[model samples]
Target: MRSSFKSSFGSQSTHRPHKMGYFSSRILPSEPSHFTKLYFDIAPGQLPIVYRDEYNVHFLGLEKLHPFDAAKWGHIFQYLKEAGVIDETAVVKPNEASDEDLSVVHTRQYLDSLKWSWNVAAIAEIPPLAVVPNFLVQSSYLRPMRFQTGGSVLAGKLAVEWGWAVNLGGGFHHCSAGRGQGFCPYADITLLVRCLLAHSPAVKRAMIVDLDAHQGNGHELDLGSCRNVYILDVYNSGIFPQDFKAKAGISRNVELRHYTQDDEYLNAVEENLEAALQEFHPDILVYNAGTDILEGDSLGLLSVSAEGIIRRDELVFTKARDHRVPIVMLTSGGYQKRTARIIADSILNLFNKGLISRTNRNVR
Candidate 1:
C-alpha cells in the first residue's frame, strides 16, 4: 500500500555507486614546487689573518674553516639534489658589500679601519705569526666581514622572494655598532637586516630566532630598540657579554641550566616561541641555526645531541612555514669536532624539507 513516490525518496534508490577513479583523482596530491637557495663565500680561505698565539689551532684546516666550506655544506646540496627537494646553485664571486651597504648598521670609523687594515696587510711583509702584521688596524674595519654580511643580506632577499634561503656563513651576532666582540668582526645580522628592511616592501617587520648556545648580545643591542624587529635568544644565561638581557629589551633570553636535555630544551622553545609569534606577527623570519648546541660542543655548555639539533631546526622552520612567513637561515656558530660537516648536515635536513629555493639566477 506504500505510495510509488516513497521508493524514489528511499536512501538505497537515491545513492549512486562510488567511482573509485573519480574519487582518487580528486584526493591525489601533486608534489610541491618548493626550493632552497644556498649562499656561500667562495674565497673565504683567502681572507688575511695574523696568528698571534698558540690558539691558531682554531683556524686549522683552512678549507674547513672557510666559513662556507662545501665539505661542511656540500652534503646539504647533495641531500636536496638526491631528494629532488630543491634546485641548488652557488652565489657568484665579487659578491662584495658596498661601503653604503656596510654603513646601514656599522659605524663609518669601523668600516674605514677594516679597509685600511686590508690594504696595509696586502702590501706588508709581516710574518704569518706576527701579532698585528703591520696592517693598519684602524678604527674602521671592513673587508672579509663585508663578504659574509653581504652574502647574508642576499640570502635574506632571496628567501623573501622564494620561501626559504640559507647563508652557509653568517650569524656574526656578536658584532656591534661601535665595536666587534667575540669572534665576530662585524655585526653581519645587523647589516643584513637593515638592508632587507630598507629594500623590501614586503618585509615590513622581521623576527630573529637565535638558537646559538651563546647569547646574541650584539644583535639585541643593534636591533633592540627598533620597533620592527623582534629577537628571541635561546642560550646559556650567565656567559659572555654580561648585562645583555637588560640592555636588549625585545629579546627573550632563555638561559638554559647546565646539563639540560633534549625534551626540556625543546619544550622551552615551544612554550616561548608561540608567545613571541603572537606578539610579533613579522613579515620575515631569520634563524640563527647554530650547531654549537651539540652534546660535546667545545663552546656550548648544553648537552643537546645531533638529533636534538635537527629537531631544533625542524621546530623553527616548521613554525615559520605554518605561519606563512618566509625564512632566511644562517650557519651561525658551531665549533665542535668536525664542526663543518655536522653543521652542514643539520642545515641540509631543513633544505631537504623544501625550504630555501632562490638561486643566483633569480636574485637581482
Candidate 2:
C-alpha cells in the first residue's frame, strides 16, 4: 500500500522500481537539531552569492547522459567573472551540510536509506550511477548536494541581512522530509525556511514564490500546512510530479498549459504575485527561479523565451524588493545547455535594475 503520492508511481516506474520499496515505515523526527555555522560574516568586496567548486558533478562522464547541466554553476560563475562583475575572492563559499544539519529536516530512516548507491542513483535520475559503489556515490554525488543545501541555508541568512542573496545552486524543491524525487536529493528549500524561522526574529513570516515549470511538490509537502509560510506557485499545468495533493496546499496557484509563451507566463506571474502580496505581507521571499521553462528544454516543455525568462526574474525581484521584503533566489531545474547562460544573463539584469547589488564585504 503506497502511503504518499511519490510512492504511488511504484507500479508505473519501469526504470527504477526501488523508489517505493525504499520508503520504510518509521516515525519522522519531531524536534529541531543543532547545526554548525552554515552562515558566515562577509567582508568588503564579497558578493552575497553562494557557490563552491564541489557543486559541480563530474564522475566518469556518466553525468553527461542526463539532460541537466551538472556543472552549470561553474559556467555561471565563470561568466560573471568574465563580465568583470565578480571574481573568486568575492563569492561566498558554503560548507557541506553535515548529518546533524540535514537531520533537522530529514528523517533518520530517510538519511540512512541514502547510503545505498541505487537509492542515490534513483534520486539523481542517472541509471549509470546504480553501478557506482556506495562510498563513491556518497562522495561524488550526494556531497555536492549537501554543499548546495548548505548554500541555501546560508543564503537564507544572507538575504535577511543584506536584503537579498542568491545561491548559484540549490532549489531542491521536489524533495521533502521523508522523500526525494525529480532529481532532488535533499529538501534544501525546507531547510532554508526552518533556518530562517529559527534564527531571524524579524522573519516571522515567509513566502515561497515557486515559478518553476513543474510543481514544487517537495516544499509543498513540507511547508504547506504551516500558517507562517505563504506559497504562490506558477507552474505548467501539464508536467511531471502532477501532485494534486500538494496543489491543494498552495495559497495561490496559476496552472499554465503546455507551450505557454512569454506573454501568458509573464502576465500570470505579475498578476498572481501582486495579488499574493496584497493578501499576505511576508518578511522574506524565497524564489525558486528555474530556467527549465526555456523554449528548447525537453523536460520543461513551456515555451518561455530566454529574454522573457530574464524579464520574469527582474519582475519578481523588483516586487519583493519594493515590498521591503528580503529575498533569496535559487537556480533550480534548468536542463538545457543554454540554461546556464540565460541564468547568468538574468542575474546581470537583476543587478542592472538595482534589484540586487554588490555588498563589497571586506575579506574575512
Candidate 3:
C-alpha cells in the first residue's frame, strides 16, 4: 500500500505538511532569505536521501595522504545503486551552501579565515594542503564540503516533512561555529539544527543522537546552552577530543571504555537511548552514525564488529520510528577502507527491516 505520509508541501515550497498538526506551530519567518534555496521542495517521487557526485573530495592525489577515504560517499551511492535500492534520478541533489547560508551559524571572521590555504590545511589536518594554491584548495576540497553541508541542511527539512532523510556525506561534529578540527571544516550539524529551529514551524525542540566514536564537542559547544535542544552522546572516552567543558551540554552521556565489545557497547546504547527518549520528546532527531568503532579501527579504539554496526543502526532507527520522531542521519567519521561497505550494508538492513522507506510511512 502507498503510505499516506507525503511531504507537507510539494515542489513549490510551502509551510510544513498537515501531518505535523500534532505539534504547535512556531512563528514563520517574516522575510524570505537566501537560505530558502537550500530548503526547496523535492518531487514526491524522489526519496529523502540526499547526495551529489561532487561530494567526493579529490585533489592532485593529496587526499590519498589523509586516512579518510575521500570518495567514500560516491562509493556508498554506487553500492546502493548496485543493490537496486535507488537510482540517480530517485535521489535528491542539494545546492552548495552559500556564505550567507553559512552565516546562520558560523562567525564572519571564521568564514573569512578559510580563504587562506594555510588555514584550510590546519582545519582539514592535511599538511599538504598548506602548500596548495588557495583557488585549487577551494575547488578540489572546500566546494565538496559546502555541498555536503547544504545536503545536511536540506535533509533536516526533508526529515521533518517526510519523516526520514539521509545525507550521504555530512556529520561534521568536530567543527563548531567558530573553529574547525578533526578533519571537519564546517559545522553542518549545527547549521541543520539552527536552520530547522528558525524555519520549520513544527520543530521547536530537537534532539541530537551522536553515536560517533569521538566526542561531538562541536555541536555540544554550539547548542549546549540551548534549553530546547537535547543531546545524548555515546563515545569512546579514551579517544580524542575529551572536552570536559563540552560534557556540560550532554543531557545523557555514556562514556565507554577502550576496546569495549559489541554486547557492552550495544547495551549502553539501548539503555541510554531509551532513557533519553523518555526524558525528552523531540520533534526532530539528528543521528550521527559513525562506523569508526569497528574492531580493527585504530583511531576509534573500540571493538564493534560489522554485524554489530548493522544491529546498532537498526536499534536507533527502531527507536526513532517507535517514537514517531523525524530523523536525519549523517555519515560522520570512519577511516577504514572497508568502512564504506559496512555503511552500505547497515543502510540496506534498515530498508529490509522497514525502518526507512521512500514513502515514509508509519510517521505522524
Top-TM-score structure, candidate number: 3
Better of 1 and 3 by TM-score: 3
Which segments of candidate 1 are over 4 A away from where they belong?
1-94, 115-143, 245-247, 355-364
Instruction: Give Cα distance to truth, residue 312, candidate 3, Å.
Output: 0.6
If the candidates were sorted by their lDDT against the true structure, best first, what order would they fall in?
A: 3, 2, 1
Candidate lDDT (C-alpha), each: 0.58, 0.83, 0.85
- Residue pairs in clash, model 2: 43-361, 43-362, 44-360, 44-361, 44-362, 45-360, 45-361
lDDT of 2 by residue, 1-364 (tens): 2222211211111111112223233212323546457867777778899998999987678899888998999999988888877888998999899898999889999999999888888899998889898888888879999999999999988888888999999999999999998889999999998888877767777899998899999998888767677788888768898998776557676677788888878887887788788877888899999998999888889999999999999999989866888889999999988888899999998888888887532111
Tens digits of per-residue lDDT, candidate 1, 1-364, equal: 1111112112111111122331123321121121112233333222111111111122223224333232333344444446554342333232556666556667888656554433333322122212343232321123444555666777787677666767766687877776665557667787667666666667777788888888787877777656667778777664665554433433455667666678878876766676578767888888888787778765676788888888888888788877788887887777654666565566566556754333321221
Residue pairs in collision within model 3: 8-17
Angstrom error of the Cα, residue 93, model 2: value is 0.2
Q: Is candidate 1 or candidate 2 better by TM-score?
A: 2
Winner by lDDT: 3
Give candidate 3 regions above 4 Å deviation. 1-35
Deviation from native of the Cα of residue 303 in model 1, angstroms: 0.7
Number of clashing residue pairs, candidate 1: 15
